[model samples]
Structures are given as C-alpha cells and as structure tokens.
Target: MDFYHESVLLKETIESLNIKEDGIYLDGTVGGGGHSSEILKKLGQKGLLIGLDQDIAAINKSQETLSQISDNYKLFKTNYENFEEVLDSLNIEKIDGFLLDLGVSSFQFDKGDRGFSYKVDAKLDMRMNQDSSFSAYDIVNGYSKEEISKILWDYADEKWANRIAEFIVNARKTKKITTTFELVEIIKNAIPASARRKKGHPAKKTFQALRIETNNEINILRNTLDRMIDRLRPQGRICVISFHSLEDRIVKDTFRYKFLDCICPKEAPVCVCDKEREINIITRKPITPSEEELKNNNRSHSAKLRVAEKI
Candidate 1:
C-alpha cells in the first residue's frame, strides 16, 4: 500500500509534536502509516507509538509500513474517537503527543470500488470502516428528504441541498440510487444547467455530506477532541490537521476555550467561576500547506494544522 496515501504537512506535524526521543505518541488516523512511520522514526526503542484507524485495510498496510521502520509502533483497527478505549486496554494513561490528520486519505478517494469519489461509478459504500453497518447507500436510499437536505446544508453548506434532496427522494422511488455515478447524475440534474457550471464537481458537496453523515465524522470530532487532550502529559502537544472550515472551526474554538482562564464577562473585575487555562495555543493561526505541498497534493489545498500544548 505504498501508493495508498501521501502524508500531508509531514515536517510541520512532527515539529509541532516536539517529539522526545523516548516519548510516547499517538497517531489517531494511521492512514497507510505515513504519519505513524515518521513518528516512530523519531523515537527510541522505548518510545512507543500507538496508532488507530477504523479501516482494517489501513491497519494492515500500516503494520507493513511501520514494520520496515521499527517494531515500536502498534496499530489497532478503530477510530481515533475511541483512543481512550485503546489506551485503557493497553494500560497507557498518558502520552507525550497526539497527531490527528483529519483529512480523508487520498487512498479512499482513489479506490473506485470503495465508492468514496463521485467520479467513481461504484456501489454507494463510503464506510471508512468496512465493518460499519451504515453506508452511503443507506443514507441516500433511506433518509427522508428533509433529513438528507439537513445533512447537506449542515455538513458541507451545499446551497442546493433542498433541490438535491428532492431529486434523490423522487428518483429513489423508481429504483434505489445504488452507485456514486447514479447519485452524481441526480445531483447534476437537481442543479440548474447554469448552476452546474460552478467550479468543482457537481456532486462534491453532496458526496461530502453523505460520507460525513455515514461516518458521523463531525459529531465524533466535536465530542472527542477534549477527551484526547486531557490524556496528554504536561507539555504534551496535540496537532490536528483539518481539511475544511467546519472541522477547523471546532479546533479553533476548542483551543480558544481551553486557553481562557475565566469565562466571566470582560467587564467583571473578579474571577468568580473556577476555571483555569488548560493549554497554550501553539499556532496563533492554523498552518497552511506550503506552495510546494499544495502543488504536490491537491487534497492538501484546504488543510490547516493547529496545535496546542497542555499546561
């Protein structure tokens, strides 16, 4: 799986970790072991790296990739949101650093049979975890028009959400919308010919909405960010690379909230509630890929890396 994924912002993410030679690190999304291999290389034999990914294919590939580097890494087939469970099972209470590359790997998009890309005419199965009972097919064929529209609007801010939902609901009555290309056609048809001329694929936003809903991506990130941060040792860093505005906003706001000592109104002279600053924001602004990185990987175009250190 050498060609499975390309690590984005590799150098920057490692640097943000401030990896100690004997430090323990967590790579929450070990897609093809790109980031985990690098993290392991920076470690001494005693410096263990625990990795997680919901995709079993990723776990197997990561095993192969990191084995060539060293046996210091252990990968599990699970989502980063379940890091606590994995850590608890391993008796690992604290980690020196955490790296969460929030972008869906290029491999998922490139694998036509997995049904992640609208350009691919394959089954509507965008489950990052192959074992997931839910898939894009269920969302498209089973959801009410209002529910589908809400997902598109809330997840990707698709302006044509209502029209697309209407189209999907109407079309599915005749036969199940069972493939990427089938949904693409519906999305294109829902859009006016003039609106279809917009930049990017007509199905891009709709597909994004479905994938996210199928995986519950946004909700997982929102619910789990702080729990992971709380497990970091003092001075331990957490570096998160997000691919879009929604995820970036969560990272930004969470970091901002953690950096604040008091939530009392600015006009209040005294600190009333018990609140202390928990972390120091390392990136005043999220780090964007360099021009070279952007050129090398178009998927990195929207990538933003934000980091914070536990106090």
Candidate 2:
C-alpha cells in the first residue's frame, strides 16, 4: 500500500517553524513528507532537511515525495529518539528548526494490515517499525490483565480499563485474541451498550492504548524532548503536533519546566538553583486545526500544535 498521511496543521506548523533560507531543519516524524515538502519549498539551495521515521514505508514514501521537490533532503529509518546519534554521525551541530508530529499516521490506520485501526480486521501487529520484535499480539496475548488495564488507563485514559482488561483475560482463556476485529469485539462486549453509545468508537481507546504500548510512543517522547530542544541552534524553533491529550500534556509540561528560570524551592528567599531558561514557549495554549482544516481532513480534528524557540 502507498504510504499516504494527511499532515495535520500543515500551515500552522510551517509558520511556527519560521524557517530560515540556509539553515538546517529536521522533520522527526516525516510521515509521507507532507510538512517536509512545504519546509523544503521555503529552503534555499544551501539549506538542509533531515527526515526521520521508524517506519521504512514512511521513509521510502518521504524519500520519493521529497526528491520530487528537491534533492537537498536526507531520509533516515530511525526513531526520533536516536536523532542525536544521527546528527552527530553526520557531523551536523545544531538545527535551525525541527518538527515532530506524534501519533499513528493515516496510512498506518488506513492500511488495515498494519492493525492500527479498530475498524480493521487484520492480525494484531501494530509495530511502527515492522522490524521491532514486540507487537500488539505480544501485548494482548501475553501481558497480564493488570498490565493491560494499567496501559489502557495510563496511555489512553480509558474509563472502562478494568472491565476491558477482565474481558480480554477471560476471552483469551478460550483462545488467543489474535486479530484487531477480535479485540474490537471484546472491547464492545466489555463496554456497556449505553456507555459505548456515548462515545465515538467503543474500541478507539483500547486500540490507541495498545498502539502506544506496542511502540513505546510516550516514553520516547518523554525522553527525547529535552534532547531535541538542546539540539536546536540559538533562537531555533521546535514545533510539535500531538494527536491526543496525553502527548500534549507531556510536551506542555516539558516546555513549561524547560522555560522556568529557576527550580529553587519557594522557601528560598534568595536565588539558589541557577537553572536558566532554555527556550521561550511560543504558544501558551496549543493551536488546533482550523474549521476549514477539520472539514477537509477528519483525522486532523484532534491535533494540537505547540511551539518553542531556543533562547
């Protein structure tokens, strides 16, 4: 299947970057190269764009998409967490700007075979890197009920976490839950009919939770934010588009903490902790999709864009 993703917040993200003509830039989640393409358009011949993704499909698609625009970009099949190593290996010092659009891509969900969508009936295999040994199948079939429940609640904020976990444990006793549809069925059964009707899809949260656990999305984001900011040149920007509140909160808190001029205890009358502010938070509140964008792409509805500039 073709790797196609509707890049959310395209205009807002590009504008947020404040791209420089000859400065180096990076797209950490270069799915289908949507934002990367626009970034390239703003770059001069001396400018560089490094595109990174864990999915080989995204890398390949981005390579093709970007090559059509310019040969000035390089695509890497590595997780964004390893971006520092990539930059170091290339002898690159600091980037003028970088972007991370965090979450499952439209292609991943639409492919059906990738098993990211609750509406699909494919095998339980939500590995973003396909090369990864762990998968949704392993989590669903092998994890303890307690573990599953915790993942559902923490990652997805699913209210029926306990019930869903219990139902999954019980159903697996008869046979393994090996497919997306099977899990969807279990989720539907676990959620009361009245409760299910109150929300969008009954299986959406469970599927999201499983995908996050399978790919270690949250942990990667948590570990990489500071490093990513540190990699920016003075006055450089970092724009992140997060799909859900969990991801948004992490980005917000990380930026908030990093922007703090001091971490001293309130009781300290005089200055103590000399932590200097690293970056200025550009958006006190996140930028959401415009109504026009929401109408054009339904998947963009949940996206929130946050930006910060190195001090």
Candidate 3:
C-alpha cells in the first residue's frame, strides 16, 4: 500500500517552526514524510532532519519519499516516547526545532487491514508497531466493562460508553469479538436510534478509544512533551498538532506550566522557590485548520496546532 497522508496544516505548521537554514529539526511523528518533506525544503545542505515513526511501513515509505531530496538525516522505526534516547544516541544534545503530529495517520485508517477505521471491516488490530504484543482485540475481549467504559469516556469522550461496554462484555461472553465489523455492529446496537441518526458515525468514538488504549497514546504524549521541551536549544521552537481535545489539553497545560513555572505564593511573593521559566508559549491559543483546509480534508477538522519556544 502507498504510504499516503495529506499533511494537515502543512504550510501553517512549517511556518510556525521558523525553520533555520542550517539548524537541526526533528519530526517526531513523521507519517508519510509529508511535513518532513516541507521541512527539508527550507534547509541548507548543512541542515539536518530526523524523521521518526513506530510503523515500519511509514519508515520505509517516508524514507523512499525523502531519499529523492536529501540524505543529510536519519529515520527511525521507533516510538516517539523514546525520542530523547534516540537523539542522545545520535550525539544530538539539542535541536533547533521539533514537530509532533499526534494521532493515527491516514495510512493506518486507509489500509483497512490495520483496523483503525470504524467504516472498515477487518481484524481487531490497532498496534502502531506490528511487533506490539497487545492489540484492540485484547482490550475489547479481555478488559472489564468498567475499564472499557473509562477508556471510552476519557479518551474519546463518548457519552454512551457504559452501554457500549455492557454490549461488548455481553457479546464477548457468547463469542470472542475478533473482527472490526462485529464490534461495529455491537456498537450500533448499543446506541439509541436517535443517537445513531446524529451527524458523525456511531462507532467513531469507541474505535478511537480502543486504538488509543491499544497503543498507549495518551500517556506517551503526556510523558514525552516535557522531555522534548528540555531538548530544545535556547530560542528553539517546538510545534505540536494534536487531533483530540484530550491531547490538546495536555499540550496546552504543559506549555502553560513550562512558561509560568515561578510558583511563588501570592500571599508571600518573595520568590521562595527557585523554579525558573523554561519556554515561552508562542501561540496563546492553538491554531486550527482553516475553512479551506477543512473543505479539502475533513480529517483535519479536529487538528489543533500549538507552538512554544525554549527560553
């Protein structure tokens, strides 16, 4: 399958990076190398671009796309959670800029066999890396009803999580939920008819919750943000595009804390604590896709791009 993903907010994200001609940049989630291609376009021969993705397919496809242009970089088939270690191994102590586009790539959803889309009928597998031991099947069949409900409600904000979890538990008892279509049918039956008639697909949120859980998405994002910020050179910037409210909230809060870390009490403001600000928030509010971009690609509707510069 062709590694195809329309880079969301392409120009906007690259512009936010303020790319330096000879500086080093990292694309932590370099899906299909779309944004990475644009990043390399702005670099001189001395500039370096590191592309990272856990999916072997993505790494292969992105390398094929980028190899035609420049070879002054590296590609890694590893999770972004270990980006700090990867950089250290490369002898790169700091970066001039970095980017992270969080969420499943279009390739994963388009290739039905990967089981990322609710519309597709495939096996219940949602591992970003094929080597992962657990997949969506494990969560759907083995997780307790309460655990499933919590993931659905917290990760996807699905209001009918309780009913969906009940339905899943009941179905699994009769037979293991091994395929995507079976789970989709169960989800449809669990939701009310009126609710099913609503705008979006009924199984969207449930599938999103399962994928996140299967890949450990939320925790990885929360844990990696601070470490990535620490790796930026003075005055270097980091831009992140998150596809859900939970991810956006984590990025926003991390940026806020890093910029306003002086936790001196208001009552006695004599600077008792020695904490100092690390980065300055560049975007007061996240930049969303323009109406034109939305019309071109609706998948970009949920994307929120936030930027910060290391102090």
C-alpha TM-score for every candidate:
0.97, 0.98, 0.98
User: After TM-score superposition, what is the CA distance of residue 199 in candidate 1 from its true location, in Å?
Assistant: 1.6
The sequence of per-residue lDDT tens digits that candidate 1 reaches over residues 81-165 is 9999989998999999999998887789888888999987999999999998999999999999999999999999999999999
Give the runs in model 1 whose Cα sits over 4 Å from its true position. 1-3, 267-269
Give the better candidate number (1 or 3) by TM-score: 3
lDDT of 3 at 159: 98
Candidate 2 lDDT tens digits, 48-162:
9999999999999998889888888888899999999989988998999989999578899989899898887899999999989999999999999999999999988999999
Cα-lDDT of candidate 2: 0.93
- Report lDDT (Cα) of residue 43, candidate 2: 92
Q: What is the C-alpha RMSD of each candidate to the true structure, in Å?
A: 1.2, 1.0, 0.9
lDDT of each: 0.92, 0.93, 0.93
Tell me the TM-score of model 1.
0.97
Worst 10 residues of 2 by lDDT: 103-112
Mark the 10 consecutive residues where model 3 has the least summed lDDT. Answer: 261-270
Q: How many residue pairs clash in all the candidates, one count each?
A: 0, 0, 0
